[model samples]
Target: MNCVLCLIENDPIAIFGLKKMLEKTNYVKQLEVYEDGEQALHKLKPHLIENTPRTPDVIFLDLNMPIMDGWEFIEAYTAIDRPQNAKKILLYVVTSSVMQRDRDRACELSAVTGYIVKPVTKDDLKHVFEEDLQELWKNQ
Candidate 1:
């Protein structure tokens, strides 16, 4: 099975660019994009009641989004039981904010596997392929 990915980012340029990048990769079979964290959470909530293939193996989350922010999603998601597919989901905080507080807060969230600065590069994505993240992409 190929790996599935999701991006919850409000920036159009960033979403388009990241989608294009993932399309060029060999492993990523699907890419789901959400304009805001709330939309992503709403879609993900259903997985708790029923099985779904839409759950992403890895998530690229933006801290600042309309409706619900990344932190809010993290809180809500963790407050309830997580779906099986989402159990190992690696949610990365991909944001432009370099503030120490934001980074610190993101790291504090159990759902957040890593915190990435804006303009995520090919090297960064490649690095994700290494280390403990190998388990997430390997399942597919």
Candidate 2:
């Protein structure tokens, strides 16, 4: 089955651009966009709690946003109690920030799988899926 992806970003242009780029890939079957971390956490909680099949397989998070930022979202999400066998969600920090601190901070978070600078290319998305598929195969 194809994968589902979630995007937590506020910039409309970035959202539009990502949607276009993601559309170019064949593995993504669904894309959910959240304006900020709070909204994302609220909306995603049920699926997460239930361990639903619709739970996103991947999340592309942005650092800057109104109300709740990516950092806050990561904190909150990681705090949630999840089943040991719950579907894994690979979260990538997709932001314009190139600061070493930002990269280091992202790496410190266990929930974060990778970090991508702004304007994620189609190849990046492809690589993420390929890596995920490889992981799944290894586990099986």
Candidate 3:
């Protein structure tokens, strides 16, 4: 249950709500927060130098932000020359965008783990866990 996660969001209310839901799972260990994708990139880039457990297990990325949006982040992140063992972030597009186009766009991105619409509840988190995190949990 030592799932380290990150939240790259600008709105304080959304951050608080997401944090509250994540806390309820009792799975997340370190929950890092960034105001934008730029901040997240700045902090996470160095970790890509090598496969390190210090990196986050999952990143709940918002599509829209003040500086450097999700698409920009995905482009930047995928460009990095990561070592083979480096733990690639399981990036999930967590957004309010309900348009089919948005989901299709997210699906087109190879780096994206999945697309999740907000306000993300505990059930959503549970479903995500069931998808892959359950295997990780069992192995742990």
TM-score each candidate.
0.87, 0.94, 0.91
Consecutive 10-residue window with the lowest summed lDDT within model 2: 131-140
Residues 1-140, candidate 1: write the lDDT tens digits.
35667888999999988877766776577788888878988887775445567767778889899899988878887776755544467778999999999999889877788988989888878866554468654664
How many clashes (backbone N, Cα, C below 3 Å) per candidate? 1, 0, 1
Off by over 4 Å in 3: 136-140
Clashing pairs in 2: none
Model 3: how far is 121 from its true place, Å? 1.4
Candidate 1 vs candidate 2: the lDDT winner is 2
What lDDT does candidate 3 reach at residue 127?
A: 71
- Please give the CA lDDT of all the candidate structures: 0.79, 0.88, 0.83
Candidate 2's residue-wise lDDT over 1-140, tens digit each? Answer: 47888899999999999888777767779889999999999999988877776799889999999998999999999999988878877899999999999999999999999999988987788778887655964685
Error of 2 at 100 (Å): 0.3
Which regions of candidate 2 are displaced past 4 Å? none
Q: How much is the lDDT of residue 14 in candidate 3? A: 95
Candidate 1 clashes between residue pairs 3 or more apart in a chain or in different chains: 1-140
